[model samples]
Target: MSASSTPAPQAEGQRRTRRRTLALCALPVVLLLVVALFAPLPYSLAQPGETANVLGRRDGKPVIAVEGAQAQGRDKGRLMSVTIAATQPEATVRLPDVVRSWFREDRAVMPREAVYPGGGDTKDAEKRISEEMKDSQHKAVTAALRQLHRSPKDIHVKLRLGDVGGPSAGLFFALGIVDKLDGDGAGGGLTGGRTVAGTGTIDADGKVGAVGGVPLKTQAARRDGATFFLLPKSQCGEASAELPSGLRLVPVGSLQGALDALKGIRTHGKVPSC
Candidate 1:
């Protein structure tokens, strides 16, 4: 080939070579970002029925039972019941606004960042979505507070936990802690005024889960004097058989449903005002 032709071919080859080089350099970075954005966080790892209280005993007996309740039809969920025998029997808990608000947004669980810089024409959308997730979680927690605050006379609580990503239980967990601090005494609303305790998640719409760790939670509630335990309907049959004496299992669907179910309860000769 002529010298001129040689130069032209060489130029074309160089251009193609540069393009390939640039693409090669960019590939690893894209892969790295994919991994970084999609990789799970250490703390994000979770297991089903892992966080429940599974001590397996009630009142020094090898058998401890908790109940779960659920109603058939739309807009209804579930409730939880527990029995336990413990030293600090008298306690009541209330739900706080912040905690309830977290569930209102429908994102009960948050895993690690999955895809960063995704669906964004610019980089700002990623950050915005992250912030929005945080805000929604906060609001869900707030909604919970509104429900628990409605009944300040009853405290010792029962709750049920569910599958992974079911952090809605966190809100109920907070309320349970509060009950431990404030027993039935007056202004806080958490009545039943006895040493009763339980566990279940609080949603904006007030749905409970048929959770695991029943044996443990039931023992905890009975130990605390929870004469009546709220449970989801689905679990009552299986859970009730394991309950000890002095504990009755009540099934409920939503939080409102549980409240309605409580209408018949006479805590201490006087009906509770919840």
Candidate 2:
């Protein structure tokens, strides 16, 4: 009986020692978790941002004009351009925020290099966005003129959207110009009398290019009352991740595809899906 009682205490002590050792082993892991939660990460957060209808007014003026071209839309429908609020090139996003962004429907996390080109400072990033904006405007106009089969010299295109810098608005800008000049080439408006929103980089040849931060842009589109969204074909998968309800996704490969999608939505015709 004495020997059995002595071993019972020894077993209890052994069990206590095992628990202490396990806790000691777990301490470093807990510390790492805390560090990870607060450590600065090389990523950027994309959040829902403002939307502007290219066919509508801003500051009591037209956002797009073909120079003496009779403005269309506003009452018929709205062609909205979606923008996303994101961390600048020089932002230090923490790991916790990045993880949180992934779970939030209105937010997204992107690699710093994916959104902003590397090997440049914040100023360089701004300059690049500015140049891209100007280039997108030119390409949008050129694509519009090409679609209309008109000479560039015959048309003077002027686009005003405040200090917004980004190339994602190109597709909407082209649509606005086309709507102002001609109505879907079928006596119908480009917007099909419905609020449409989209994002993509435009080429002079009418090819649409993928723009990042599409998931957050989709949230902005839905928030802005868009019934249809035109996004580049390449980023359809990304856009589908957090797409808000009541917004149909239209995958466009070019300027003409987007116009057809809007027209299809109006006429219930066959439209391409993402």
Candidate 3:
């Protein structure tokens, strides 16, 4: 209205113009940050993966079956083997995904090389994993036979699972074989009608070996309704990092140890734990 009032409104308009300009000037920087956040990194994101019951059927067939032996418990309670769903070595991982996964208790971020040892050649990585899976299966059969004091040449065991590859299934593979053959040694199923899960590598000597990504596998087990986990004694600490509710860890270092623990669980006897 007055000249003074006119100057005040003019100044206010100028201030608004400057603020808008500043925001416009900062837009590129914000966009750059967003782009960087979404850009690919050399890491892999992982979470709970698939679970298979060793003592049960998949696709209408036995997961673990033994020939030329008095097999038992093919329909017994579940012996679940857990896996992780991880970004493959060939897949792209973003920074923002990594940052968010870092704070998540149920998730994991892994070095791409760790998931695939040679890194860039995804085909080679997959081949290696497949080879490891085959080797683990062979070793599991040998270990199970040895545990039962049976000769490998005289016995035949078959293991099958679709598209899953890793040595981590060795422990469960062996257990499943043992369950089908011997069970709990008292005419009872090894799992005692309870759902159990685990992951570990195994040697022909029956020694259980550590498999990385225990936390993720543990989560997978819990998600698949497993109440007991057969843990490699060495992975006790890792499995405890984000243990799920109602899941129990049974620490085992050998096939015999795992059998004993399962027996204890079935009979409500004392069992060693992590």
Native-to-model Cα distance after best TM-score fit, residue 70 in candidate 3, in Å: 2.4
The sequence of per-residue lDDT tens digits that candidate 2 reaches over residues 57-116 is 788888986774554433388989988887887777898788788787777787888888
* Top model number, lDDT: 3
Ranking by lDDT: 3, 2, 1
Between candidates 1 and 3, which one is better according to TM-score? 3
Better of 1 and 2 by lDDT: 2
Candidate 3: tens digits of C-alpha lDDT, residues 1-274 = 5554356888999999999999999999999999888888888888899999988788888888777878755335899999888876767788878889999988899888777777656688779999999999999999998898998777888898878898999999999898888887767788888898998899999999998789988889988899999989988998987899999999999988988998888889989888
lDDT of 1 by residue, 99-206 (tens): 442444211222223222233322354356445434433433444445546332332223323222323243334333322233122323233333324445455555
List the candidate 3 regions with Cα displacement exceeding 4 Å: 1-39
> Cα deviation of 139 in candidate 2 (Å)?
0.5
Cα-based TM-score, every candidate:
0.36, 0.85, 0.85
* CA lDDT of each prediction against the hidden true structure: 0.40, 0.85, 0.87
At residue 83, give the lDDT of candidate 1.
23
